[model samples]
Target: MSGPVDAELARVVRDHAGRLAASLVHLVGDFSAAEDLVQEAIEAAVRTWPVEGIPERPDAWLYTVARRRGLDVLRREKRHREKLTGVSWPTEPEPDDRLRLIFTCCHPALPRAAQVALTLRVVCGLTTAQIAKALVVRESAVARRITRAKQKISDAAIPYRIPGPDELPARLDEVLTVIYLLFNEGYLSSGGDRAQSRDLTDDAEFLAALLHRLMPTEPEVAGLLSLIRLHRARAAARFDENDEIVQLQRQDRSLWDHAAIAEAGRSIARAASYRRPGPYQLQAAIAACHAEAPSWEDTDWTQIAVLYDMLVHLAASPVTALHRAIALRYVQGPAEALAAVDELESSLAEYHLWHATRAELLRELGRRDDAQQADARALALTANPAERSLLRERLNWT
Candidate 1:
C-alpha cells in the first residue's frame, strides 16, 4: 500500500542511515540521542514525503530534519541551550564519518559479540531482524546486545573519533577482522538461497580500501587488501554458467581478473617489505601463490604448505589447522593429509568441511563406500544450499 515515493524514501533512508547517524553523533556528542533523531527523521519522512513528493536532495533533507529535531530538544532543555548555540550541522556527512563510526563500534572495550552486532547495526545500517537472520541468532539476543553496547558507549563516553597512530595498529586489526568476516559471509553465504551476495562483499571491499588509504603504512592493511583482491580476482570463475558452484581445480583460470591479481601481487610485496609476518600477510602470500600459478597442476603446493605452517604457528586455531591440512594434501599426499585430518576429528566433529575433506581423501584412496558415507555426513552437517548441492553431486557420483 505504498507508492514510488515511499519506496524511494525507504531506499534512500536505508542507504544513508549509518552516515547520517554517525554525523549526528559527532555533532551532538551523544550516541543514543543521535539514533533517536534519525528514527524521528524517518518517521517524519514516512508521514509527509509520500504525499508531498520526494525531494531532489533526500539525504540533505533527512539530515536537516534530524538536526532541527535535535535543536528543538536542546532549546527546551535549559542545560543544553548553550550547547545548541555552538552546533554547526553539515549538509552531508563527513567523508570519514562511517569509518570513524566503525572503529568506535568495534572498540576493544566492548565484548566481541557486542562489537560485531553494534558495527553491523550502527555502521552497516542493518535492522535487528536482518542481523539476527545473518548471524543465526534470536532477534531478542541481537537487540539486547545492541542495547547494552550503546549503553556502555554512552556510560563510558567513548570518543567519537578515530584513534591516534600509536593505538591505531591494534584497533585497526580488529576493524579489518570484522570487514573480512563480512566479505567471507558474502563470498560463501551460509544460509541464503543464493551462493553469493555481491552487496556485502562490495561494501566490505569499499571499507577495506578506505582503511588502506587512511593508514597506508600498516603492513597488515596492505596484506588484507591483497587477500581480498586475490579472492575477488577469481570471482568470475567461482560458479559455472548454470550458477552451480565450481570446484577450484575445474575452474577456468582464463576467466580470472588479471589486473586484480597483479595488484594483489604489488600489495603483497609492499606488506612483505615491512618485515611483519602477521597472519593476514602469510595468508596473502598463500593466495598469491595460487594467483601466480598458470594452472592447478603448476601451483607451488610446497610453498603454500610452508606458508600455512607459518600461519598455524602464528595463530593456532582449528580453522588454520584445517587449511594447513588442505595444503598438506597437495604437497605430501592423500595418506599424510588423511592422517592430519583424522587428528582433528574430535575438534571438528560438527564442521562440514572436515567431513568433506575426509571424503575427498577417501575417494582418492579408492575407498568409494567410505567416501560416500563421509559425503552424506558432510551434507547433513552443512546448512548452505550451495554446499549441499555440491555434496549431493559428489555423493551421486560415488
Candidate 2:
C-alpha cells in the first residue's frame, strides 16, 4: 500500500508471478488452486512487505509463501489432501518448467481464445482487468474465460510436466506461439509511448533461452532464439534520445548491440545444421540479412525477398505478406511492392502497418498527396505513441 512497497509489489507481479505460479502448479497439480495461492501470497506481500521491508529475494520469498499456502489449502480440503499427498513436494523448478507451465496453459485441448487468455493471465502475469483492456473485451468476460480455462485444466487433469521428446514438436509450437506473441507485444508494443517493455522482452528472451537449452537439437527453437536476439540487438536503436521511434535506416548502428548480433548468427548456424527449416528460421534469416548489412541501401534485399517468399509459403498471413512486400521494394521496385500492398488492402485495411507501407511505396512513386493520406490513415489507426510519432513525421515530409 505504501509507495515503495506498492512499486515492489508491481515489480514482483510483473517479473515473478509466472514462476511462482509454475512452482505451485507443480506442487498442487491444480491450476485454479495454484493461482489462488499465488494471489494470496501477493496479498500477504502487500500487508507484510510494508511492515517488514522487502525481502532479499522477493521471488524466492513469494514462492516459499505460496507453496506453504498451497499445502495448507490441500490439507484443509480433506478429500483433495489424498490427491495432494500423492503429489510429491516439487523441488525448486528450473527455468524450463515455466515453459512447460505455459505450454500446458495454452494447451490445444482448450479453446483458442481461452488458451490465449489463460496464458496471458497465468503465465504473462496480466490481471484480468488488464487482459480485458488489452483484448478489448469486458473485464467480466475476460474473468469468465480465464475461469473456464482453469476449470478445463482441472477437469481434464492436464499434467504439469513438459512434453516428452516424442510429443515435444507439437507442444513446442504452442509454447513458441505464446512466447512470440508476448515478445511482439513488447517489441513493437501494443499501445504505449515506450517502444518496448523491457520486462516482457526480457521474459520472452529468457523463455527462448530456456527452450534452447532444453531442446538444443530442435531447429525451430534455435530459430526462435535467434529471431529474438536479433531484434533485441537493435532494441537500443529503435527509440531515439527522446524515446521516439527511429526508422530502421536512421537508427544509429553504433547503438546496436553487435555482441547480440553475433550470438544471433551462431543461433542461425545452429538452426541451419538441423536442415529442417521452418517459418521462424526463414524469418530469422531475413533478420540476419539486415543485421549483417552495413547500411539500408546495402542490405541484401534479394536474399530477404527470397526468405520472405519461403516464409509466405510456410505461414501465409496478411502480416507476412505485408513484410514480404517491404522486401520486394528493393528487389522488384516500388511499383511491384505497391501492387503487393494494394492486393492486401481489403485484408489489412484496419492494420496500421499496411497504410504505413503504402505511404512509403506511394512516396517512392512521387504520389505525395496519396502518400500523405495513407500516412494519415496509419497515424489514425495506431494508438502506439512511437508509431504515431513516426507517421506524423513521415506525413510532414515534403
| TM-scores of all candidate predictions against the true structure | 0.83, 0.83
lDDT of 1 at 300: 96
Clashing pairs in 1: none
Model 2 misplaced stretches (Cα beyond 4 Å): 1-23, 42-54, 57-60, 79-90, 93-99, 111-113, 120-142, 159-168, 190-198
In order, the Cα lDDT scores of the candidates are 0.78, 0.78
Error of 2 at 17 (Å): 5.2
Worst 10 residues of 1 by lDDT: 190-199
Give one digit per residue, the lDDT tens place, for model 2 in 1-398: 12454545656665677777877666666668888777777767756877898888888777767766766877778655555455443356787777777778768788777876777667656666656655557989888887888888888887777778888778888878877876786677632443222345655676677678777888998898899999989888877667777888888888889888988988898789888999888889989899888999999998999999899998899999999999999999999999998999889999999998999899989999999999999999998777888788777765
Model 1, span 25-114: residue lDDT tens: 776677777766776676676667778877777677877787788778777765444554566544366667877887888899888888
**Global CA lDDT of candidate 2, please?**
0.78
| Local error of candidate 1 at residue 89 (angstroms) | 4.7
